[model samples]
Target: MRQDKNDHTNYSEVAQLRQQIESEYRAACEGLHGLAMRARHDFIQARMQRVEEYYQELSSIVGPEAAITTVIKINDAFAGTQRKQEPQP
Candidate 1:
């Protein structure tokens, strides 16, 4: 490709601007990641609490086998959601 000869563009200024924008983007990404982590933690904690309550209730109604199955289902649901939220290549 033939380059332009009269290209007197201020590349240094552009480079500085790019660096500033990239730094801001990185900081925003970090903040988002922290928020996501907290949200995921809270969701899992609430889920586990509900599961414990359900397990107790179901155990009394049905049996230990049913309780185990319910627990497995709860785990599978969380795993599926986490997988969906993960980044794809």
Candidate 2:
């Protein structure tokens, strides 16, 4: 049916938007870490604001549980990378 086709298209669009937002959120977090390490307080605050906005947008699209899951996954990945880069004893 035509309605079924439209529904599928809408679902696809939502999926794409969710993915784009998630990627932006990941990039913002990565940049925020660098800013914090460099002691760029002003830039870090601004970046943190942007990161919160990204979370709100993602939550609107995918619900809070899914949005938080995405955040947790990204954070875990970053933590793992940081651990690997730390100097060994």
| Model 2 ranges off by over 4 Å | 1-37
TM-score of the candidate numbered 1? Answer: 0.45
Runs off by more than 4 Å, candidate 1: 1-36, 40-46
Q: Each model's RMSD to truth, in Å?
A: 23.2, 3.7
Q: What overall lDDT, based on C-alpha atoms, would model 2 receive against the true structure?
A: 0.64
Expressed as tens digits, the lDDT of each residue in 1-89 for candidate 1 is 13343232334433443344334333433334545554455454554555566566556545678656755654565456556777999
**TM-score of candidate 2 against the unseen true structure:** 0.60
Clashes of each: 0, 0
The collision pairs in model 1 are none
The best candidate by TM-score is 2
Give residue 51's lDDT in candidate 1 (0 to 100): 51
